[model samples]
Target: MNPNMTPNLMAVLPTLIIMVTGMVVLIGDSCLKGWKSTKSLSAIVTLIGIAAAGFFALSRITEDSIIVFGGAVVIDSFSNGTALILLATAAFATLLAMTYLENKNLNLGEYYALVLFSTSGSMLMASANDLIVLFIAIEILSVALYVLAGFARTDEKSEESALKYFLLGAFAAGFLLYGIALIYGGTAGAAGNGGTTNLTLISEFLRHTNGVANPMLMAGIALLLVGLGFKAGLVPFHMWTPDVYEGAPTSVTAYMAAGAKIGAFAAIVRVFNAFIPISPYWLIALQVLAVLTMFGGNLLAIVQENVKRMLAYSSIAHAGYLLVGVCAMAGNPRAHDTALGAILFYLFGYMLVTMGSFGILIWLSKRGHDCTTMNDLKGLAKTDPTAAYTMLIFMLSLAGIPLTVGFFGKLQIFNASLMAGQVGIAISMAVASIISVYYYLKVVWTMCFQEPDGNTVEGRATSSFGVNVTVGLSAIGCVLFGILPQTLQFLINASNSIMRP
Candidate 1:
């Protein structure tokens, strides 16, 4: 290796690979004429690219952190681990989409390409060391997702979802960019560095200056939080979540719920942890947001009959749980390991369960029918025992039942919060979780105990080997992680070294 070469290349190698792969896929699709050839080839390429990226990310397991691109990006344990998770998520989602699109005759070559491109953006967001780069990455990811959400443009609901998401996402991006400009202004005037938007420089400036509490800096931080909060789907800014989830294609919804949340949490953790000296002022804001998000999300989920809508609310509630981890880090920067570890564990568990649950939706959406309502699952056990069983495991895991990955995830989060003296937030989380069980179990009951409606009873049932494998793997992961919780703890500890605090 060249002694002058920076290790940051190794950190962002996955994102760079995926970005190149996306362009190749796009070109191939444009040249390839037939649906079967384009779909199969594109899917293969996408999976291979994601796997390659993940492998590259996993290979960099050293203890040191490296900043790349003139300090515009950072490679550390935290980002590398998150990049692996994001790539895996994109790969599995592509697999699910391949089968789903084939069944629905919706396999466009651009779909896989867009997913890879968006995932690359999310990876960049996770690793970004500069505010401008972070904002750009967020827009790249958001734009792709907006298009994907409205992929079924023929459907009015899909079109509506896309429009709403686009408008609100654009609005959020504006706030974020403006916030970056303001923060740049504050730091620039004080440091004579022409408004340095670099996070490390900003941190140094805050440390050396008496203007840490400058009104402009506070305003910028608030705007930045609002922008990120919208993406994370926290309360008071989560209005778009339910409608979008209910309207988007099921596979896309799963990708957004799992992969997007991981990216957002990673950004949140980085922004707060890296700027900890001035974070105390915002800790109170996060505390209040966490409590409200937990209670409000669970309460909304209780009344939703549409399974997708309910899951949307549940996603918000999960954001609240993650926020507790964020709050813990703010209050006790020394406990970075515990806080970040819990967040990652929770994200890992959440991805498995959510993907498994949405896999059932994709599998059931055969012959142009979208089976999204709770009633549609009635008599699922009788018609398709394997899918029902898989969904059951997912439901139980999401409900945080014992011997499931979700249980261990919650345990770690609660432990972290307790250690950080956020007992009230933890207690609220527990209660909300109890309330959530009712709706999650209601699906299980509908699947196992209720009689099938005439339409579903007469409808054909089909299962693809690909869907079966995905669901089976996810269910096994939930059970295995639950049984071997220490494995996750170790991974979390290893990843913690990259966190800024």
Candidate 2:
């Protein structure tokens, strides 16, 4: 073995482990013909793989930044922390997928493998230090998700969602690649540094230039923002979110809402932190996007009768809240530690609520039936108290009620924005949060106060033990994290110490 290759392999051990495990799962599925249950085994293997990756990532927590593959990737605390969260989300999503797929007769080995690959791609994207590598990582993730979204090939809505997502995703990738090319050209002409595509080098160049903004660089940054904004489900680029979430399998939707957001935000942090000196230009653009996304998402959510689609709009609104933290980080790079901390905490809380909400939906949906509308949930509390209570916890948390994780998450971002002196934005965020309460509570009212539609069977939630566990864990996590945020605060601080610039 080459001596130099060993160290590089060690640095990327987590990604390698996931990739290899995915291949093994594929092979195992082919070999285990007429097995009792391939879905259960697949979920177990995926969970074990993610746990191993998390362990490996934690082992490197104390190690300084280790650049791999000639600076294409960099392993640091920020990347490691984000990787852990991605793995955790993927693991939970796999469990939920297994239960839901089995119920819907859609269980397949390929689903588990695809989830692992997508998660690995997200981790790679988070750690990537080179523009080309980031683009490649994103494609790996997007391709897997597109296929997953259309896994129910027989469903017309699923097929339509997949097509729309693929076309728009491809278009966004083109813009991102063009932006990279522009940045390369500008750097090559000005500094003669062989058209450096490394983010660190570009940041250093900008810092030394004393605020001399390049038109090419500015254009590149704008395109890059557009691409990332689409992935993060921000407004003007979030048209795909509601349709896709409504059409996709509930389990896949949960994964997208949690894991995808985590990966996108991770990349946003890496890019913004490395290119801090030129953030003023992007800050203004993000400010406008944030406002539009916040108000638009909430307004659209209020009008949505479909629960899944409403949650999609709610996800967009949460992304807007996250952007507030991103804006603060951009405005004062020196204070990015707090902003980063807040973003991580918010994501953790958001993941629990999102997963719980979707899991309950899966529980309520029968094999041939889709429970997408709020009307489907009318009188759910009277029919199935357990699932209804779980959903209530999710809704309350999502609405930022006290004693729920979502409340603390919003508080963190609001405090960060206030610290950054964004008073108007902060106040608008508060008003948006209030607007959000109306729709979220509408679901609660339907469950508790409204009569049953009389067309559907009752007690749909009583049969699934696996879903019960998932929902219970998520609801409990929401309350625990909300009441005692210091645990997450400590983790955030630890993550910040390793990622500080």
Candidate 3:
């Protein structure tokens, strides 16, 4: 191994802190016996750890890139920014879990521990410099998620969600591993060395040999895309998303929706940025995938009666929108800063909006009422104006309506796409957003215009305090960032870091 390439502790401290926090929660939970609600202590621990990690990450928000752990991980503005986003997702989800699980009878120490583990895995994925490290991170995130999906053991649907996710996730891992092997074989041979999984080394080898036209390398790239495509909820690999999101506990669903997408896209950016030499070979395929995902996800969401499933499809559509920025970044060698900035901003917006949407579900839920379907939300405006208005903002944001975070995010992404010469995809994305408005507005019309269905809960006087905090923060984030995104200038630095030499 190259000595200069040795791993540095400072570089990975954030992820390490998160991992250590999970271990402590696990050990603490096992040793201390207390009221079921007291298990929320685990959540408290998890939040502190996440905030610490975020602090460490923010402290290192430099524009220059710094590789560590033999280049298996990197510390840069991009990594740090992404780490903050992951931490925020974990924090908000943990907060929601505090009250959410207590009500559902699923509150346990292990639940918070799993969330920390999953979030740390996502943090790893964001900074990974090697394909092997990325794969390991993916597994770490996926395994924790499988368990969290079914944490509500009494629910058959939750169990089913866990099973399906595991099976499909295993296959996707296979695809990624195989792709890594192929890239290694194809490039390492050219370098007269044994196969390696370090992305930088592979990129260097390919660049020296002008390997863009090499078939084996192309095959590997395609396979890697396939694997990542699944995690990002892109088309053809998205079958697992709806069932998983709808079946999993609402808090877990919120976690998966944002955390998973951010991590997957973070990896996608790293891989494609490394493979910029082979842009022609992969750009068209990716563009096609983006188009299919956007149209397909929106069309499917329009027909769904279940709000959770609609959000599932909506998540897929948002994934497609993000893909537009990814594809654009991959194609525009000189425009990565703009492309990445847009992608980062969009993810931030989507995270808050999606989290708030599901956070509302967690807030309104009763033991017998999941608050899942459209009918369940009828006349929600009449009984709970705050919840109704909150949902309205979330809905408008998702629909990309003017002045909402979602709208600005979409605007930035489309601007980036056009700058990258992806005019066709940009136009397609607009149409899909317009089409999405129908369903999004359908949600608004249902909650505002429709009468109360008997299905709506008499409502809870005292839901978990954590959920209210999550809802309030999410609501504030959506509008605050939408109106005054100047607060997010760190993201610009973060995006710029990824484009550095």
Candidate 4:
């Protein structure tokens, strides 16, 4: 085989496996229609596929980074580790969905298929080395999510959420494509052969030329940031996040919150790493956006009466924290590796915490009705002590309390910011974290101290083996990683070692 034509297939084995598994599930669902065991079988197959993909991804974490498919994709520790996070998230979401789907009369095989396909796209985004591949990967993920958002077609909010996400998502894609076009035109020499859409080549070109001075290249970079920042749920472009997150099913929201953010930030780090040599020109914009996102998300979350909306805003704030790591990556060359490692660590911790928090909501949801309002949690301790305590840990972690994974995740980012000499950003993060505590603890107090009204989810908590397992595992992981933050340090370190072509 031609070296460029075949390259190393092992590098992308995980992504291939995920994509194939999605097809199998989709087909199997259609063939097994009306079978009593079809629903359980779908969930089982989804878990097995995710486990296989995660195994491949974890193994790749220690392998040397290599570019494949003519440099359009790169198999590096960064991509591999991110792939693992995305896969693990999918697995957790699958587990949560098992009973939730059955409760909502949505135990369809297509649901599992969409989850698998979306996960594959997230993996591809992490590995994308070329602009074209990045765009395709994003679309693959977004299209599936748009459908998944409206999976509860009978519900008007679900349908509305899907429509809104699709519209905004389409516009974001346009911005990304336009940015790529401008970048390509700006880089192309008068002879028409020097321009490239490959990130590595773009970096080399910019390093050699005064790329920042070129109007087209500068505009493209700005637009590119706008496009991706929207996906990452940064401030000003985050109007869609709350509505969409609240309207989607709790199970989908859990997956979307973690899986989408991981993919977006992975792409952000890769794209910006290529632009790091010109960090001075772009760092200010990112810093401003980070400050806005943190404050905007936190302040807005404080007054939310609906639990889903509150958590939705919370997700936005977490994105701000992740952006701090991105800023640290660009602000100081010396802090690059540390910042990248911090980001991956933060993503892992946040995924566990977010999934667990949302899992609680799913557990409390009654048949055909979501238990997402603040009222539903009143006096949970008196009725369901196991659930109440699990939620307490989740709330504490989100507040960044001592000895929780959330606290350590923020600490690493804070330290990285200080290392990068971003004192203002560091302080901003601290203040924002403090502000977040009020809302998170309010949740804890509602469950533990308050009296339940006539109507509360605790009075009618749903029991599901799958949801219990998901929440239990998430809480344990949160506490474990918090006490032994160093346990995953080596993996984070390896994951940040992105290779340049």
Candidate 5:
């Protein structure tokens, strides 16, 4: 609507490339209905598109922040950095899905298309400057995920996962929309223009007035947290995580774990950054949520026998740790840069670790069945040393073992929390990490020490080359970034510059 055509178009180039790629894949797949290589071709196309998008996003790292499309969207260091992470996530998911779909007899061209579409949505979420844009971005992400969850159409569990996610996801969207409406009403007179849903405008209004005293604004913020918290898989709203992660296909689970969290947390950080002025009213609520999510997720994961479900709970715990970084952003303007950089770095590291862990399951899966239980991994070290070692790396990283990216990421967050003077939260996070170590080590112990049962496949060879690549790349990322955190200095710089008031 705003006639800043060139800048606005350039601002959205990466997302545009992704959406176009999805359409191209869809059309190509439809036109090549009888070709045997259609599935592979779709994957190849999707990967190239993601790579191109990443290139464009990387090119924007040094550009000045630009609010485009009448402030509905923005292109900034934060968005550029987030886009790269999302693209990396989509690339890895595509690589894993290549062999995974073939093994499950679910190799459809639509799978890659949906992944591209969903990733485009995630990219938009990271840059969204308006509440309406954020909601649209979320739906674009959620709808594709619902379909991907049920891609294994014949699996009853897959269908149930899809149904539950869709129902719960719709309710979450409702909460988010209602929250936006209330904020719009509460701020109706603040800007002297009826109302505003633009984040920048909201900040401008709040800076001049007392947002905490406005009951409607406070209520809106609470509901908004509920909606975003549900998406981030925080405790009290994390009921769907274990069931959905267990029931979905392994490749889908990996993507859902990484991509969804990246997008949701990016939005959470950005939205809450806008609310920093009135943080006294909401910071306590977030702190409580962080502690609850950290302990609840770890304590529950300790009892899980199913590997996928355990990882699901582990993902929730990691969200709590990320929330600790979010808490650091409040009441301490000086700590904002450290906290934001830590959160971004942590998300990238977690993406690599989580996807690589699940990639092992995809690698071991037999045709038409997923290797899901802890017992399925028993004696894996003897049969597939490569996968076992790779899994070991992911487990150690998840447990925050030294020389892994997870440890450094956690360390940064720990320091950031302390910088904010949240000694209690810092201690709680340390205890939670200790609690998580047991379950992660349990995974490694089962893989290396336990005897193979009758259900364990004998002499299993790596089934998919794509999965091998995914696991290998993820392992390298985990260690490479860990040993040399400076490798991510560009992303850290981006995080440091974001959300400045």
Candidate 6:
């Protein structure tokens, strides 16, 4: 089939593939007999579907951007880069969930199906070029995740987390939709034609018409921050993160951490990047939020006795770092590609660490018990030295210690900040990094030096090909990228490509 003859289909090929696969999975779960009854079948199907979609996305990386469906969704390098990250995260999460579900005896086929469905939504969000399209994509992802948050039907905390996520998420969605309405009203009045939600059209209106001076348009952008910032787990809007993370299954926690950030921030980058004339206004707000998020998240994490909650806070801090890169490009839309690329690279590294760390946490959990508190890790090095070593690496990476992906990722982001002459924020990052050390290292030191409390109960760490590979690869990736000088250049180039359209 000629691509030009069916541009809409071609542009949404991956999304369709993922959507169709989710339907197939739902069908399989409902109709399959004994042999297909195991949830593994569903997980396998989801993995295959996500893999196919990811391959399709990669193949289109060299193709020119195509805005289909009346310019609602645009396939471009920026979307592809973000889509690849979401796909990788889904793969790892699927693998983690397979074992997690089986062990907990909570292997509902709907779990994997929901993940695939949510992932497809994230993909759409990344490619969305219109406000209406973006809002729909956000709801698609959020609705599925709201259910998944409490997938463990018997757990009270799971139910609470799911409820909290849904309510807060709905509130955020209202803000986003209202922002879109305001923007549409402003544009319609200024452009003389009926209102439009398309980003490209909106940018044009701002540049070529009186839409720039429209108070409602600027107010709409501010409202957009409230909505997207909440989604990205920024401060004041971040209250839900720790509770939800600690309440949800570790596997789901891992998936949501990176996936949500990827989608929300992609929208943030696109908006700020395209609306260059409005940069000075939003940039100051983003910078202040970034600083608060950095210091606030790090400080809160420092006092957490629970590792899961600590990671929840850590996620917030990482979002702040990503925001810093955005602020670095505040005065220079030309730096959009480079700044976004740096954020993407850091996200990749962060994903690796989170997957491995939570994988270990999953392994430490036995049926009817969640392994999380810092005390539970005491004497882990004595019991399982290999696992201990892996944890050490992840901790070091999280702390931004040298010779790990996390280190280089921080270096690039900080370098971008300095280039933008945002020294105060850079210094805040440095201080936050130092303050973060005590907690990260505390985990390492506890694992290596503390003795097992006589009364402390522990689960036997299990081994399987899937778990081993996930953990090993993430740890290796952290170190491999750290020392590999060529990888950094490759990331820069890949990031540069995102703006080709």
Model 1, CA-based lDDT? 0.83
- Predicted structure 2: lDDT: 0.84
Clashes of each: 0, 0, 1, 0, 0, 0
lDDT of 4 by residue, 256-352 (tens): 9999999999999999888876777789999999999999999999999999999999999999999999999975555777888889999999999
Writing each residue's lDDT as its tens digit, candidate 1 over 1-501 gives 675554555557889899999988898888756735543888888888888888778777444678887889988777888887788788778877877776666787788988998898889888888999999889888999999999887889989999999999999998998888888887765447577788888877776764256777778888998999989999988999999998888888989998888888888887776567777678889989998998889899989888899999999999998998888886564555687888888988998888888888877776677878877788888887777878899888888999999998888888888888878887988898898898889889988998878645332233566566667788899999999988765458646665453
lDDT of 3 by residue, 23-134 (tens): 9899888875662346467888888999899899888887478887766787788888998888999999888888677778777889888999999898889899999999
**Which numbered prediction scores highest in TM-score against the true structure?**
5
Score every model by TM-score.
0.95, 0.96, 0.96, 0.97, 0.97, 0.95
Best by lDDT: 5
How accurate locally, in lDDT, is each candidate? 0.83, 0.84, 0.87, 0.88, 0.90, 0.82
lDDT value, residue 280 of candidate 1: 66
Clashing pairs in 6: none
lDDT for position 103 in model 6:
76
Candidates 4 and 6: which is better by lDDT?
4
After superposition, the stretches of candidate 5 with alpha carbons farther than 4 Å from their true spots are 1-3, 33-39, 459-462
Error of 3 at 226 (Å): 1.0
lDDT of 1 at 476: 91
Candidate 4: residue pairs that collide: none
Q: Compared with the true structure, what per-residue lDDT tens digits does model 6 show for residues 1-501?
A: 765648688788888888999998898887877626553888888889988998998787656676888788888866877788788888888888877777777887888888888888888888888988889988998999899899887899989999999999999999998988888887774446777788887777767753244677778888888998989999989989999999998889988987888888888877666565566667788989998998899999989989899999998999999999888766444555557678878888888899989888887777777788888889888877887889999999998999988998898888888877789988988898898888889889888899978523364444555567777888898899877835645445545544412
Candidate 2 C-alpha error for residue 492, in Å: 0.7
**Residue 46 lDDT, candidate 6, scale 0-100:** 89
Model 2 spans with C-alpha error above 4 angstroms: 31-39, 189-192, 455-457, 461-465, 497-501
